[model samples]
Target: MDPLGALQEPLFTVLETPVSWTEVLGFGSGALCVWLVARQHLANWAVGIANNLLFILLFTDAGLYADAGLQIVFIALACFGWWSWTHGGGPADRLPVRRTARHEWAWLLAAGAAGCAGLTLLLDRATDSTVPQWDALTTVLSLMATYGQCRKLVESWWIWIAADLVYIPLYAYKELYLTSLLYVGFLALCAAGLRSWRRDLVARIAVTA
Candidate 1:
């Protein structure tokens, strides 16, 4: 079982049909959202917010509560990122495509870890969650990544790359093959976004110098 083909084995079937309207539209909006993010276009937020709404409907029906909840968060984050990109730096427009500050990194890590653990415990205890642990982790990690993106941090892309890599397989296990393949494609785009954003950061720094 090769890594690339790893999603094919023991394919699942809770929601059997593929290429439904919800999923097909999801694919289109999802791909556009990523493309806009890769270019660091602020308009990505608009597409992202729409994608989140679409996925919220889809994931809720599919019984992926965490994924659905994460989409809700993405809505807020998308609006936030849009505003931050437009304004709200420290006193000026000096906050274009920068690395995360040391203070921000510490809080980000602490918040992400605590959030994941807490969500896992709560879900495991309260909800009829099938994979409470994994779902919680993905939610928390995705929150961290979305926050990074909101700030235009180059590290955001790397964060997404890591999560989506795992997400690809997880979706496969749940037998959302086309969606799984979408995550695989997302992983590649995230890598590209990392490189592209790094270059933009360097250029921004040079100009400031």
Candidate 2:
């Protein structure tokens, strides 16, 4: 038997859609990666690298080309995040979490909007993407969130939550039930992360004061 044959074999069926082993694996790793990140664990980046690769395959196979491309970007960001988390805190040993400032939020919002518009036009004209608008919105916002996460900014969770809300419905429409479910799990994890990071920020402020 060809080893690649199993890639298409359904591990189960959900809502008349075949849920493949690849999607299952992607969902599992994604959930674990998000949970670990919520706890501020250094290991999250390594797991996230694996998740990004798996998602790249899954989204590409599903014809979600924009998302597939986003995963490629995610892999690069994950690598940068791994290094930053390990060594980017000066002499503090770990990067401290901080709330995003108003000026930084303004820049991020503007960049996200511009990126979404550009990607939407590109995907609409250049690709056969099914849901270009929602896809582009999530992809650009996710890029911002990942960058914020790398810098240990507490507001990254807010961006992730916004992206996840859009992703859940979009994936469900695409019949990527497992990936949709993963986004649901991600919403819960984002909540946990926001709270955890907020506490960390509070303590840091107390210490500096």
RMSD to native for every prediction?
A: 7.2, 1.3
Candidate 2 residues 12-112, lDDT tens each?
Answer: 99988999887998999999999999998989998998888777778888888899999989989988998888887544768888878899999998998
Model 2 weakest lDDT span, ten residues long: 1-10
Candidate 1 C-alpha lDDT tens digits along 1-209: 56322322333333564444556567678888888988877778898888787777667666678888889888988888888887856436534788888999899899988998899998888778787888888888899999998888888887898789778888777666777878888888888888999998898779789
- At residue 57, candidate 2 shows an lDDT of 75
Q: For each predicted model, how many residue pairs clash, with residues at least 3 apart or on different chains? A: 0, 0
Q: What local distance difference test score does each model get?
A: 0.79, 0.90
lDDT of 2 at 2: 62
Give every collision pair in model 1. none
Q: Which regions of candidate 1 fall more than 4 Å away from where they truly are?
A: 1-17, 88-95
For candidate 1, the per-residue lDDT at 179 reads 78
| TM-score of model 1 (CA atoms) | 0.87
